[model samples]
Target chain A: MTDKQRENLKNRIAVVAAWGVALIFFFPIFWMVLTSFKTEGQAIAVPPLLVFEPTLENYIEIQERTNYVKFAWNSVITSFGGTAVALLIAIPSAYAMAFNPTHRTKDILMWMLSTKMLPAVGVLMPIYFLAQKAGLFDTKLVLVIIYAMVNLPIVMLILFNYFREIPKEILEASRMDGTSTYNEIRQIVMPLAWGGIASTALLSIILCWNEAFWSIVLTTTEASTLTAFVASFQAPEGLFWAKVSAVSTLACAPIVIFGWLAQKQLVQGLTFGAVK
Target chain B: MNRTLVRLLQAPSIILLLLWMIVPLSMTLYFSTIRYNLLYPEREGFIGLENYRFFWTDAAFFPALMNTLVLVGSVLIITVVLGLAISVLIDRPFRGRGIVRVMLISPFFIMPTVSALVWKNMMMDPTTGLFAAMWNAMGWQPIEWLQDMPLFSIILMVSWQWTPFAILIFMTSLQSQDQEQKEAATLDGAGFWSQFYNLTLPHMARPISIVILIQMIFHLSIFAEIFVTTSGGPGVQSTNLTYLIYIQSQQAFDVGVASAGGVFAIILANIVAIFLIRAVGKTLTV
Candidate 1:
C-alpha cells in the first residue's frame, strides 16, 4: 500500500477502536435504562431476555412505594446549602492567599489538601458521636457542614488559581485610589473572577450531591439523600433488579443532566492547575 | 481598619477548618484507647492498646489491607493506561467528537452508590443482567460477577466511574503539547508509535502521576460501591479496610476496634501521600 493508504487505514482503525471503547464505557448506563423498563420477572429471568414488552411498572412502583421527592429534596438542600457555605468561606480565604503574600500560605494550602487525604472513616466515630450528642444526626444542616469541610480543599485550590489569574494591577490601582478592601473585593475581584467562582460553586454542589459515605452512615430517614435512597434497595433477600435500576436511574438523572449541561465548565474546573 | 478588617474576614474559614480537623481527630484518638462499644455502653473504660492489639491480630486485618492495596493499584493502572489512549485518540479533531466526549465523560458524574447499584442489578446480575443476557444468547454460561468475584467486580465498577477523570486530565495535558515538535517528528520520518512513546509519554508523566495519586487517595476510601453492591459480600472476600471498619463500628458496634482500624488506614494513606507529594514536587521543581 502507498503511504497515503497506510495513513488512511490507520485513521480508520483509530476511529473504530475509539467507537468500541466508547460503547464499552456506555454499556452499563444503557443497560440500567433498559432494565428500568422491564418487569421484575423479566428483570431476573434466567438467560435474561433482551427483547420484552417494556413497562413503566418499575417507575410507577418506585414513585408509589418510595418518597422520591423527599430524597431529592434532601439532596438539593444539602448540596446547594453546602456549596453556598463553602463558597462563603473559600472566597475570602482564597482571595487572601492569592493577593496577600505570606510565608505560611503555601503550607496552609498543602495542609488543607493533606487533610483531605485523611480517611473519612478515621474521623467517622467522633463525628458520629458528636452528631448524636449535639442532636445533629440525620439533619440536612449536619450534612451541609460536613460536605463543605470535606470539599474545602479543592474549592480553595481552584478559587486560588482563578484569583491568581486576575491582574494584580487592577487591585493595586484600586488601592492607589484609596478604595477600601471590602469595596475592592466586592466590586472588583468578584466581578472579574465571576466565572471561576461560579464553576467552583457548581463543582462543589456536584460533589456534595454525590457524597455517599456520610449520607449513608449519618442519616437514617429524615436526612437521607438520594444515595441513601438507592442504597436502601440492597435488601438481604436477593436483589430487586428492576426496582433497583429504576431507583438508580431516578437518583442519577438530575446530576447527569446537570453535568451534561455544564460539561465544559466542570471539565475546566477539574483540570484546574494541571495543564498550567 | 482596612488591614484589620481584611484579616478578620479570613478568620472564620481558618477557624472552621481547624475545628473540623482537630475535634474529630482528637476524639478518634481518645476512642481508639478506650473500650467503647455502642452495644455495651456500660462497659466503657480505658483499654490501653487492647483494642489495637485485637484489631492487629484479627484474621480480617491483613486481607482487608491487601484488598485495599489491590483495589487502588488495579483501578489506578487501568484508568491511567486506558485514559491515555482514549484521550489521545479523542484529542484530535473529528466529526461528532463533541457528542462522543460527552458520552464518555458522563459516567464520572453519576453518584457512586447509584453507579454501584446500577452495575450490580442491571449490568452484572448473574441471572438477568445485560452481561448474563449477552452470554446466554451466545450459548455461554452466565457468571455470577459480584458473588463469585466481589472485589474484582467492585474494582471494575469503580474503574468505570473514574477512568473518565483520568481521561479528562490527560486530555487537558494533551492539548498543551507543542504542535511544532509533532510536525518536526513527522518530517523526520518517526513512526507514530515511536513519536508517541518518545514525546507524548514524556509530556504526560506529571499528569499520569497526578492521576495515579489522586485516584489512589479516593480509591483507598471506597465505601459506597462495595457497600451497595456486595455489602462486603459472600464471605469477607470484598472487604477493604474502609468497609471492614464500617462493619466493625456500624454492624458489630465495636467502636474501639474500628477506631484502631481507622488509624491503620490513616497511616497507610499518609505513606502514599508523602511519596506522591515528593514525586510530584520533584517534577514541578524540574
Candidate 2:
C-alpha cells in the first residue's frame, strides 16, 4: 500500500480496536443496567435472554424491599459532609505548607502522608471501640469524622498544590501579609485556588462514596451508606439478582455521572499532580 | 498571623494526625501486647506476643498473605499493560474517542461492592451468568468462577475497576508525548511497534511506575470485593490480609489477634508508601 493508504488503514484498525476494548470494558455495566430491566428469572435465564419486555417492577420492588432513599441520603450526607469537613481542616495547614514554607514543611507533609499509610484496618479496632464507647457508633456523625480523617492527607496535598500555584508576587502586591490568615485565605487564596479546590472536593466525594471497609464495619443500620446497604445482598441464595442489579445501578448512578463530569480533575487529583 | 493561620487552623488536622499517629496506634500496640477481646471484656491481661503468635499460626494466615500477593501482583501487571495499550489505541484522534474514553473509565467510579456484585451475578455466575451463556453457545461447560478460582475471580473484579484508573493516567500523559520525536522516528522508518517500544514506552516510564505504586497501595488493602464475592471462601481461597483481619475482629471478636494482624498490615503498607511517597515527592520537588 502507498504511505497515505497505509496510514488510513492503520487509523481504521485503531478505531476498531479502541471501540472494541471500550465496549468490552463497559459491558458489565451495560449488562447490569439491562438486567435491572429484566425479571429475576430473566436476569438469571440460561442462554441469557437478549430481548425482553423491560420492567419497572424491579426498581419499585427494590425501593420497597430496602429503604432505598435512606441509604442514598446516607451516602450523599456522608460523602458531602465528609468532604466539607476535610476541606475545613485541610485548607489552613495546606495554606501554611504552600506559602509559609517552614524548614520542617517537607517532613510534616511526609509525616502526614505516613499516617494515611497506616492501613485503616490497623486502627479499626480502637476506632470501633472508641466510637461505641463514645456513643458514636452507627451515627452519620461518626462516619463523617472517619471519612474526613481518612481523606485528610489527599485533601491537604491537593489544596497545598493549588495554594502554591497562586503567584507569590500577587500576594505581596496585594499586601495580604498584613491581613489575618482567615481573611487572606477567604479573599485571596480561595478565589485563586477555586478550580483546584473544586476538583479536590469532587475527588474526595467519590472516594468516600466508594469507600467500603470502613462503612461496612463502622455502620450497621442507622448510618450505613449505600455501599454498606448493598453489601447486605452478598449473593444470598439465588434470588434477588434483579433487585441487586437495580440497587447497584441506582447506588452508582449519581456518582458515575459526577465522575464523568470530573474526569480531568480525577487525573490531576488522583495522580497527586504526578501527571501533567 | 502569617506563620500559622496555616498552623493555627491546621492544628486540629495536624494534632489529630499526630494523635492518630501516636495515641490509637500506641493503643493498638498496647492492645496487641495484651489480651483483649470484645467478647470477654472482663478477661483482660498482659499477654505479650501471644496474640502475635496466635495470628501467625492461624490456618488461613499464610494463605491470605499469598492471596494478597497474587491479587495485587496480577492486577498491577494487567492494569499497566492493558492501560498502556488502550491509552495508545485511543491516543490519536478517532471518531467518538471521548465517548469511548468515558466508557472505559466509568468502572473506576463504581463502588467496590457494586462492581464485585455485578461481576459475580451478571458475568461470572456459572449457570446463569453471561459467561455461562457464552460458553454454552460455544458448546462447552461453563467454569464456576468464584468456586473454582476464587482468587482469580477477585482479581478480575479488581482489575476491571482499576484498569480504568491506569488508562486515565496513562492516556492523559500520552497526549503530552513529544510528536516531533515520533515524526523523526517515523521518517527513519520506525513502524508503530518500534516507535511504541522506543518512544511511547520510554515516555510512559514514570506514569507506569506511578500507576504501579499507587495501585499497589490500594490493592494491598482490597477488602470489599473479597467480602462480597467469596467471604474468603469456598475456604480461605480468596482471603487477603484485610479481609482476614476483618474476620478476626468482627467475626471472631478476637481483638488481640486482629490487632497483631493490623500491625502486620501497617508495616507492609509503610514499605509500599515509602516508594509511593518518594515517587510523589520527586514530582513535587521538580
Model 2, residue A238: distance off in Å is 6.8
Tens-digit lDDT track of model 2 for A1-276: 899998999899989989999999999999999999998888878788889999989899877877898999999999999999999889877877788787777777777876877888899889998999999999999999888988898888778778878888877866745765556668888888988889899999999999998899999899999999888888576559888889999999988998999888788788777776
The prediction achieving the highest DockQ against the true structure is 2
Q: Which CAPRI level is candidate 1?
A: medium
Candidate 2 CAPRI-style tier: medium
Question: DockQ of each candidate's interface versus the true one?
Answer: 0.58, 0.75
Model 2 off-target regions past 4 Å?
Answer: A176-183, B4-6, B40-42
Which candidate tops lDDT? 2
Query: How well is each residue in A30-65 modelled by candidate 1, as lDDT tens digits?
Result: 878888899888877776667999999989987888
TM-score of 2: 0.97
lDDT of 2 by residue, B109-191 (tens): 99999998898888998988899989999999899999999999888899999999999999889989999999999999999
